[model samples]
Target: MSNDEDWYQRYLDMQNEYDYENTTDASYVQSKPVQLCSKESLNNFGATIIPVFYYVNFLLSYLGNGLVLFIIYKYEELKSVTNIFLLNLVLSNILFASSLPFWATYHMSEWIFGLALCKIVSSAYFIGFYSSILFLTLMTFDRYLAVVHAVAAAKSRKRAYAIIASMVVWCISIIASIKELVLKNVSENQFSGLMCDESGYPDSTMARWRLVTYYQQFLLFFLLPLFMVMYCYISITIRILSTRMKEKCRAIKLIFVIIFTFFACWTPYNIVILLRAIQISNPGEGVSMCSEEESLDYALYMTRNIAYLYCCISPVFYTFVGKKFQSHFRRLMAKNIPCLKRHVSLNSQSTRTTSQKTPHSTYEY
Candidate 1:
């Protein structure tokens, strides 16, 4: 056998024969030594990239979502069924961003916060992350019903219904995150030191659990919801074009913006993890090249930074693109940035009409 194949074979043999109970060092059989990121590389990569991204995301997400919450609280018009969903979306972002400081510190230093805090923070992060996606899905459905089946939607629409839906989404997300809440703890990484990493060894059972969760995340968070969003948006587009619902044009634009932003921020990260999942699922083998493994490690690090940046991006999108949001935000800014209020006119930006506009009309949502 060639040297490469022989080396790979031996690595696999070692992995299969490894006894975690006896071993002091938790070494997995990987073909590429570089795949196990070195301490200097990790410090340079993790400390610099992750903390910068996390802190930026945290600050912007907090400010943006906080502003949305304030707008909802201060304005009478922001209480519509659709806006209620938007309110919940902002809340999800805030909740998600709140977990960032812990993670930022975790990535930069050791897991000094102990096991219980690790579990709580991880649970909060998962709940916030998943719930944002769920609420977005709900918003799409609300739009679909409002535009495609206006009268029927109106008959069914209640402020109470939106509240109930928001509660259900949050409840489901929290329940789904319970496993992570239980599993997460402060553990020692050979390279990264005592950190809030997964405590499990890379054994068969953990591998299976990882596979299941990976599939669950891909389907629930990415594939299925993406398909649903596409269908809803497309149907809404067709109806709007046929009826020339010009006011609904902004709503359609918002949908496109949201879908594009979501995929842009999340697709590469999800794809990288999915590849890792496939590797994990069928891992009696080793990678062929050190550079290949290094590339993948870099890819994961970069893509995760991109995904985390989404929490920051979301609030900006709502603030800039959602005309109603812009109007209210300007009003808030005007109070402080006093000279800027001269040109502000919310009446023109208002989506409400004598008939309350289409249910899915801009900000009518």
Candidate 2:
């Protein structure tokens, strides 16, 4: 029995030694490093988190943006040069938010929708994103010209000019998004399922493409737009302070809030992508030591979700904050929604009846 136990222990030792030798062989050692940012992390973080965010933003944006669209469409009085910009802004947000479900599904499972939709959905997202910034910038500029050169703007800022500007903005947005239509497709890896991502090109080309697009979005969408908005608003603020236009307080406050919200959501997202672009440039080993790249992955993940939320809140800035829009919204809400109308009518009736029942109540009941 003792001799058998010693022999079994020696056999186990020999097996462990042989296994270690095989593991350290040239072929095994030379194998490419595993991509940490791929399936496992996405399955854990993205699939669990992104769909909820996508759906929440989708519902909020659809209702808010859709309400703005409805108000503009139903009421002729709601239409104006600034309101036209708001209309386009709401439209683009709705168009963008409509694609959220697909992205959510893409992250969770296969891109079962296919290649054509991948292109359309992907391109539409960018078109919506760029158009959003464009309209917001134009809105700021319109306000700037209106406040600074009121009489001149009144003469120049016609409905025709707004329509032409809307067309131009849409055209530019579409032009910028054409690359997504060409590049975005269903991913081929079985493990990743059918992902609708930019996987049609080689690694080198994809890296270059990502870098170019990152810089483009950073410069055009974020930085330049940020500078322009801040400049216009700061100039407007100075002008207002120098003059006696106290009624401009509400508008300026809303503008400040809008700019702050935009930056809060997008600045981190852009910074994360810029870090990713920088990491991509470093190739392999040297870049991996930045706290295991998980922090970068998580940041990119979280910031993207934050960015999508802006569409949901934009209508709050554009419509709900405006007195005209509120009155119109209230009227429209009272008119179309029977339950709301009934509630309001009942409340009014009860108030009138109570007034009539009171001693000093000769007021119309």
Residue 293 in candidate 1, Cα distance off native in Å: 4.1
Model 2, CA-based lDDT: 0.78
- Cα deviation at 185, candidate 1, in Å, is 1.9
Give the poorly placed runs of model 2, Cα more than 4 Å off: 1-39, 77-79, 284-292, 336-365
Residues 145-261, model 2: lDDT tens digits: 887677789799999989999999999999989899888877778687677888768999998988988888888888988898888878877766576443456556766787788
RMSD from true fold, candidate 2: 10.9
Listed in order, each prediction's TM-score against the native is 0.80, 0.80
lDDT of each residue in 1-365, candidate 1, tens digit only: 99999999999888867765335443544434443423476467878788888888898888777777777788645457977888888888888889999988977877888888888888889898888888878888887888788889888878989999999999989988888775676777776688775556556766677787778788888788788888988887787767645466666676677779877888898898788787676543234543445566788888877877785556556546755666667787778886776655444344334225554343332
RMSD, each candidate, Å? 9.8, 10.9
What lDDT does each candidate get? 0.75, 0.78
